[model samples]
Target: MISQDVGTRAISVQNVTKQFGFFNALSNISLDVAPGRFVSLLGPSGCGKTTLMRIIAGLDRQSTGRVVIAGKDLSLTPPHRRPVGLVFQRYALFPHMTVSQNVGFALSLQRVEKKKAANRIGELLEMVQLSAFADRPIDQLSGGQAQRVALARALAAGPPVLLLDEPMSALDLKLRQAMQLELRQLQRSIGATFLFVTHDQDEAMVMSDEIVLMNSGTIVQRGSPEEVYRQPRTLFSAKFLGEANIFTGSLRREGNKSLLQSDVVNVRFDVLGARDTGAGLVCVRPESITIEGASKEMFVGTEPNSVAGQVREAIFQGAFRRYLVQVGEQSIMVQQPVLAGTGDAFSQGDQVLLKWSDQAVAQIEDDTNG
Candidate 1:
């Protein structure tokens, strides 16, 4: 069992629901983010990720449920009263204020002493590596610099939990990647719990300790990046996380082996006992399927699992070659290292063998909800 710390609960959402007219933005969502842990709510648009974040920050109230932060029930806490810091996607810094003044804005609002606020501003600037730009106006800073200033301003109030709502989405690809690492390091240095929301799967996988995947006003799955990638509990999760080829097939058991019978292919595999129960969908990552050499094919028997495919298109992708192959009526994608083998250079119609390990196939539920 996972034990909760006795001191405080960082953030808890119990049976939360939110609606807008006839549309349900969020439906009975419950999640707990551990103290000092980085958790990300990840999903596509209209999945209610932003709605949940707004509720936590007190920017929007839930129709029904409880929000507890640091062991305090936030029933009446407004946005300003809650011990939370929010950094928005558009750096919302004051144009008229200098970097130092912006960072000290929260302290000034609370009637903190001038000398103490100055020291706090200096500390925050140093923390976000913006100490040298303290005197510069907000308009003069670059996108990354502006984001750092916004972060500094958010932390000025010494909030225990920080909420980032697509904070790096405005930057370019390279800058966004760099900022993800920097933000993760900053979170560790500050020792504060971070609840981040983003639609980018790569961003969530790169920065989060745990990820909550939502779709259609419900949470599809939640787990570590590796766990979700390796053994996805649902077909939606498997397809959403990365490239996967999903095939529906009937299952039959004989002795200790399981056979998946499809319309175009019949593959025999060995799975844990549950897979042998009935029909299900099989998910295979493109990288897991391989092209065999002439010598390798001699040792292995050609039957159910192995299928003949014709290369429909081959695109060179610098690091790898992506091949779109047609096997009967189904199209399967396979990727290989650019520098590997040359027995039969495949063209638009060249026949190739598609082989995969039985262990690579994962059984997912065939229901629409998955």
Candidate 2:
């Protein structure tokens, strides 16, 4: 991990809006990335993550707002004049060039000395662990190797900021997973600010120092992966980053606590204030709920944080057992870790009680219509 100074920003985007015809691709988006930090622009496809990256890279101009890269305002600068490197999804490498030639293309454009360019290419190939295949043609390399070549080419100019737009989407699952770690390590070692754009939640979680979640060209939430996952502020943020079981009801105040009453489930949790006292929605993660066998007598007057439900479906995934329990009119998903050499704990058609702590449930806004 790279330590970052919050006092300084490597890339600052202020109130940027990109308009195409009448369709607003990005709407008043603003972001600040610290030096040596890895930030991910995470969202679904067509959510304007790519448009934001293009605007930062100067490939597409923002309709309004300023773009400052490495402390210089470059809103109207051309792509080549910006102090940022770009890695596209398709790589766009020269098929006729070798790995060394591709990695040194930017250096050659600057008219650097031949020996200096060769040394820089050697260093980059070694950094990406492709020194052994430096002479291989672009078409002869594997998907992972090609991606590394593109990364090396992007970093050839030693730009202060690097913009990667789904550079690993073409690789297989296993290779992509492996490269996620590799790319993270590369960013840490190089200490350059990286802005990665991906729709993959897992990818963003594994690699980013911070996650900026966007929806409909607007930022939904921005925080660390664990913070966003554990404390989502809205329904979209809750459901998009991970699986969540939402409980909705009318909210009422009880001293310093808040109680949500519903026919299906009632939740009583501590609240910081009275701002949220109307329509209440709470999100609980599947792994946070515990399941145990229960009888009809145990569910007479249901208590807060406890619910009795029948197991409708039980799946034996390798690492955990996923159970879909039918409670009232809703079905809640619960995951239990599968201990090695232990048999299944609960089977289908069994009665079970699910319980979770109030701290495990996050209060989220009902932004379904937003």
Candidate 3:
């Protein structure tokens, strides 16, 4: 792990592992989150994201490694004693309590005076924009409203860090998306480090300042949304984060350029330059490919990165059309924005030329499973 400045990090996890009998749930997990930043722990099911969050929250202990929050190691601290707040997917607000009561729960536990707790609850409800509903029963609140109350309760103690475990998964898509924005705004406004955990790629991308992508109990990649999405470092990262058109090939360097001979696609690809090519895997996003109707003379040119193909399928989304172009044994996807003269768009059985630039294609390193 790189040496970190103690003052900058709100949470630091170093070489943490959690094992259940012979099964390793987490393997040498190390991550550093800066103060007041929204960082998402993202991965598929059983990837150890929740396990890691539990460890950080002190609900579950790691087999090894140190967990530090706000410059103090919390490895030995109990959940309630730790300087972190937690919100879960199912918040499980007390059905017997009112919204104000729930928001003041932590303050009451801390033995704050009744007047002080009431004032704090009032401030929290105002912050969450639920002051009007402070007296409502928990059983009567909507899913979104309950989540807001849960968030207010978590924030009542003003912990330096907040850990959310798929907090919006219970809401519908529209409400979930709206909550993503609201949660992000709340974190920024409160200036607290938020460690959000989710398996949804779009939610992570929309909410996180940095994404810690996990797979098979290990960190696959960590970066800003654009960096990890557009410049993935591994095959797992490329495929998991978004849609990727993958091609396996043998790489050969020719002077300043590199060419790949694909055994699967039965074609050659020109790459921008040489790279470590023990087993070449290239990834291009569907949106990067441009498709136009192929002419008889189009294949005659010596274009470096063009594929002569025929449209095998086309799907029209609201703003764009998705076309599957068959070039030799490979079928490539191309997405183009809908333009004027919709009747002139490429359709199935239409001959087309597919092309993309060197910058549009990225090389991915094969993972253990690949």
Q: What are the per-model C-alpha RMSD values against the true structure?
A: 3.3, 3.1, 2.6
Candidate 2 clashes between residue pairs 3 or more apart in a chain or in different chains: none
lDDT of 1 by residue, 91-174 (tens): 899999999999999999999999999999999999999999999999999999999999999999999999999999989999
Poorly placed runs, candidate 3 (over 4 Å): 1-4, 263-278, 296-302, 340-343
For residue 285, model 1's alpha carbon misses the true position, in angstroms, by 1.2
Error of 2 at 41 (Å): 0.4
Question: Which candidate tops lDDT?
Answer: 2
List the candidate 1 regions with Cα displacement exceeding 4 Å. 1-8, 254-257, 267-270, 273-275, 293-305, 339-347, 367-370
Predicted candidate 3 versus true structure: per-residue lDDT over 217-313, tens digit per residue: 9999999999999887788899898888888777777555566557434224345443735568888888888887777555522465577877889
Model 1: weakest 10-residue lDDT segment is: 292-301
Query: How badly does each model clash, as a count of residue pairs?
Result: 0, 0, 0
Clashing pairs in 1: none
Better of 1 and 3 by lDDT: 3
TM-scores for the candidates: 0.90, 0.96, 0.93
Q: If both were scored by lDDT, which would come out higher, candidate 1 or candidate 2?
A: 2
